[model samples]
Target: MEFDYVIIGAGSAGCVLANRLSADPSLNVGLIEFGGSDQSIFIKMPTALSIPMNMDRFNWGFESVEEPGLNGRRMDCPRGKVLGGSSSINGMVYVRGHACDFEEWREAGASGWGYADVLPYFKKAESWMSGEDTYRGGSGPVKVNNGNNMKLNPLYEAFIKAGNEAGYPITGDYNGFQQEGFGPMHMTVDGGVRASTAKAYLDPVKHRTNLTIMTDMMAEKVILENGVARGIELTSKDGKSETIKVRKEVILAAGSIGSPTLLQRSGVGDAASLSAAGVEPVLDLPGVGQNLQDHLEVYFQYKCKEPLTLNSRLGLVSKGMIGTQWMLFKSGLGATNHFESCGFIRSRKGLKWPDVQYHFLPAAMRYDGRAAFEGHGYQVHVGPNKPSSRGSVSITSPKAAQKPRIQFNYLTTDQDVEDWRNVIRLTREILNQPALDRYRGDEIQPGLSITSDEQIDQWVRENVESAYHPSCTCKMGDRDDTLAVVDSNCSVRGLQNLRVVDSSIFPTIPNGNLNAPTIMVAEKAADHILGKGLLSPIDAPYWIDEDWENRQRPREPKNAMM
Candidate 1:
């Protein structure tokens, strides 16, 4: 098969790129996914997002090889294998990340990636469920919905009070003006179903003449000739290997794990590592699979003393009511994505932006439990906004089907340990706040007696796990930096007609969830590739004021620009 643009992996970024590039009906675009379709019933349910955590069919249930720094215990790392990729399985929290995150990317040699430059792309890709206004877009494939019919978890509100008591102001919407404070989470849902990238971008365009989407097709390696990427050698579902040529470009949107693995397999990685893996090095890029980062999180679980949790409504009556509600009005608990609320807060007073993020769940969740337990319980998931620890991923073999060696050196640095310690403490403080006093219970994870920083650090090393936001493997930087694998445009340093359009190209992980930023990258790259218009931002409408809350949406162009 031959195409104008070949995209590997039907992930968040891949789906967006496919939709944008294939908009021109003349261009032939090919998108490949190693897994099956997103036809699973549970995947479409808003609240069942976590059901994929230990499920093997839709997830690459990769685990670290016991990190010595993390008490020699391996932690589960789940990457979505189906269409839409991780966005299909992730908790549907809509986050654009902190504005400073992109500014930092620009400072680190990624020239055109400052917050101002990326903001327009963010707006271009969003269809705000909250409403169309200055900060939102009205005509985009991806849907962003605020508050579902489910009642707000009280614990989430209490976190806001706690933060205020600690002197932080309430940030109405994290994706809006401020990124500090606790509030109800905005989810990527359309009506009552999951608004995944596949549902929003790929599914709607499946019948398009220019796009060809293949599922269960594994890409083994990029077919490089001399120093340019020409095509890819891949094995189909029946084990038939063939080369698919690309006339224009080969884009690797295969995510953090898949991108690095495919690059190394194609002889575009660190020369020393590729040689050891029985592959000849083509680019000798040392940073191909280095600089791995993830948000480490620990869950503070408690058994509720009252009937406020999901357990209280797990019976037949509630189930029937939820079903009827969804069927009738597209509302109720059935539409809820379990992560009802979240917060961004600093562990102490000195931080510029919040260093810790919280996920409030109204249920007691155990790892891989056989049966669900319901009660009036609330969970505080403490995640480090930015950890200084870094790790790497490498291909263990030349085979396409084999899983790569993912080494997440969690809690490996002093800064990481301190951040985790402070987050855990801050979580406890929020849980013990006056608003949650009636619902609060004994500390079960680390227990209340472990007050010392050393004890807290030890607890973190034993319990903290990945939030699955890996990046910087094929870091984007300037040609001057020898460690740089990809340039600002995401093209490999020494390879022509080859580019990476995924989280793997991030020079560093953004300050919040990565999905939105990954999509923004594709949106911007699409304009750059299509030669649609001037790369500069079209001046913001004078009526679309900086105060987005009170501003009216600018009138849309009749046919919309790509």
Candidate 2:
């Protein structure tokens, strides 16, 4: 088969590219996925998110190779294998990342990717439920809203109010004007159904004659001719292999892990490593899989004094009611992911932007919805967003079937370790504030006894888990940077007609969930891929603590009790 554009991996990025590229009838666009359709109810239902996230049929099932920083433990690395990719299986939380994060991208040689340059794309990718503003998008493919507006449970209210009681700023919307504050969180959901890329971008345009979607077909490698990507070889579910010619460009949207490994398998990564993996070297790029980064979070659980948390409704009958309500009226507790309130704050005084992030959950249970506490309780998931530690993802052998070796080296740096210590202490302070006086009981995960610096470090090392935000494997930079695999336009270095449009091209992981930003990247890249004039930069105002250099947190409560 031949097409003008062959986009690999029908995930968040590829789905948008497929919809945008195929809009012109003159161009033929093909999208391929290793996993089947995302038609399962678990994928469509917002609250049943944990099911598809851990299910083998929808997950890629990648794990770290006994990370040295996690005390020789292998962390679960869940990347999406299904049609919508991780967006279909994630918690549905929507975060655009702090604008300052894009400034950092510009500093790292990603020219034209500063906050001002990319704000237009971020605004274009979503149709926010709150309606159109200077910053938020409207009439877009993806539907987003403040899930349930934290009204179903009072615990969400307590968490945000508690942050203010503990002397923290409270912004109305984190994705909007300011990010360094506590406020309501947005989710990619509307009318009780998830707004994954496949559902939003692909479903409405599937009948287009120029577009083709092939599932259950794994991409083997990019076919290159004298250093130029000419086609891509894919293997079917039944083990039949074939090469599809690329008449225009071969776009790699296989995500951080798959994209880097495919480049290595195509002999485009570090020459020495590719040769060692039994692959002939086609190029000497050494940065295909380097600069790995992710967020590590530890859940801070608290036993509730009242029967007010989600735990009270964990019985079989209650779950049945929730499912039935969603199935029938598309309302009730199943309509949202229940991650209503969140906070973003800096760990230390001198940092201009928030380095730590928090997610307030109404139920104190494992991520898989397995009950951990016997009765009513809640938990705050906290972590350092801008971790300094780096690692790599490299192929073990020249085979597409083999999972690549991943090592995040989490907490390997002293800065990362110091940040976690602050993360636990700050979250504990927020949960202990007077707003939670009526509901707070005993500390659960890192108990009240775990107070010392030594105790905090030990507890964090034992309990910290991946936030599922892996990125920066094929980072973008200028052509002069040796570690850069892609240039400003996401075009591969030393190659022609090849580009990687995904989170993998991110120069650094941002200060929030990667879904919104990943979609924004693809939206922006679509213009470049079509040779259209880029979106005009929007210089919108953003906020940071004015006295940040002198104070780590607010000296006194900003808002009095209402």
Per-residue alpha-carbon lDDT of candidate 2 for residues 51-84, written as tens digits (9 for 90 to 100) = 9998999999999998888788899999999999
lDDT of each: 0.77, 0.92
Q: lDDT of model 1 at residue 472?
A: 76
Candidate 2 worst ten-residue window by lDDT: 553-562
Predicted model with the maximum lDDT = 2
In model 2, the Cα lDDT at residue 39 comes to 95
What is the alpha-carbon lDDT for the whole of candidate 1? 0.77
Please give the TM-score that candidate 2 achieves against the real structure: 0.98
Off by over 4 Å in 2: 557-562
Q: How many residue pairs clash in each candidate?
A: 3, 0
Best by TM-score: 2
**Global Cα lDDT for candidate 2:** 0.92
